[model samples]
Target: MLIVFGLMIAGGALLGGEGDSADNKSDTSAATKSGSSSDSKLKDNYHVGSVANHKGYKFKVNKVTYYDGSDFDKPKKGNRYVICNVTIKNDTDKKQSYNPMDFQLNANGNSTNMMEILTKENYSQNTLDSGDLDPGASVTGNLIGQANKNANLKLEYQPSVWNDETVKVSLY
Candidate 1:
């Protein structure tokens, strides 16, 4: 009876180990598939809004600023991040729906290596769905990301009305 109990305990342990390995593999495969799906979606053609002469319908890069986490005056770290505040105005005399995910930040001139900036360190999609902005209404927000100090920042936006082409505005 004692030998049988010991064998049963060992078998249970082995089974647990196998189960853990399987779970790990399953998690890794799921993560890989999830990442690939996001990549494919990003590569899809998106619409770019045309530059209109309307006073508030234009999008502008208001400012590009950097902050060092340290309070004391030390040389800015090379890895210090930059925050770009983009202002979008809706002067088309109609309501506009904007998806923040469709907006991207480009460093220097490299669009392929573009990094996503989350609103408040969360991975959630930071979209602006304020229904419609009446004529002459404007909205502003910051896109935060890690960047080299003094790096050139560009804002690329695809408007709902425009088809799949990205419009860029640079702040040097």
Candidate 2:
């Protein structure tokens, strides 16, 4: 009985050795509610409203809203606003600076950075570069993008300027 129990415990440790632990939490069920795991640059994939974390920084997307320029009579007829209410947490020892430009919106395999328009005054609200983030600091704001259909929109974040690895999140 002792040998059998030891084997079982060893098996458990081997099974959980990957990045699925609580501290290194990974949502590896993208198809289901469990979320999905990372594949190299694509760290973790969340289903729309779930929080996605990478390299200690936690990102939570609160809401996604699209506005048609027709009512406001601002943008062209074909252009629409894709706004994402997002929150960023700085889990670093040194102060960090996040530029809204560092974020990208991927739709239909095409990627675009934050929108730059003259009419909209609050395009990059509460974004990463809003201020210097102290350790454990979190900032939330609305990031805008101009696209026709906001479906299959994924939010891509590169926490550090030194590396190309990104935390790709699905904002479904």
Best by lDDT: 2
In order, what lDDT does every prediction score?
0.56, 0.66
Q: Candidate 2, 120: how far from true, in Å? A: 6.4
Q: Show where candidate 1 strays beyond 4 Å.
A: 1-56, 70-77, 109-131
What is the per-residue lDDT of model 1 for residues 1-172, given as tens digits with 9 covering 90 to 100?
9999999999999999999999999999998976765532332222223232222356655666665544432333674555555567776766776656666666666542224344343222432333455667777666555555666666677766444545666545
lDDT over C-alpha atoms for residue 113 of model 1: 26
lDDT of each residue in 1-172, candidate 2, tens digit only: 9999999999888777753564354333433332322332344566557776554557777887776754443544566677787888778677777777778888777888865443555654343345667889888887777765535778777756325666666766
Per-residue lDDT of 115 in model 2: 51
Q: What is the model-wide C-alpha lDDT for candidate 1?
A: 0.56
Question: What TM-score, over all chains together, does every model reach?
Answer: 0.47, 0.62
How does residue 95 of candidate 2 score in lDDT? Answer: 78
Q: What's the CA error at residue 10 for candidate 1, in Å?
A: 84
Poorest 10 consecutive residues by lDDT, candidate 2: 32-41
Error of 1 at 43 (Å): 23
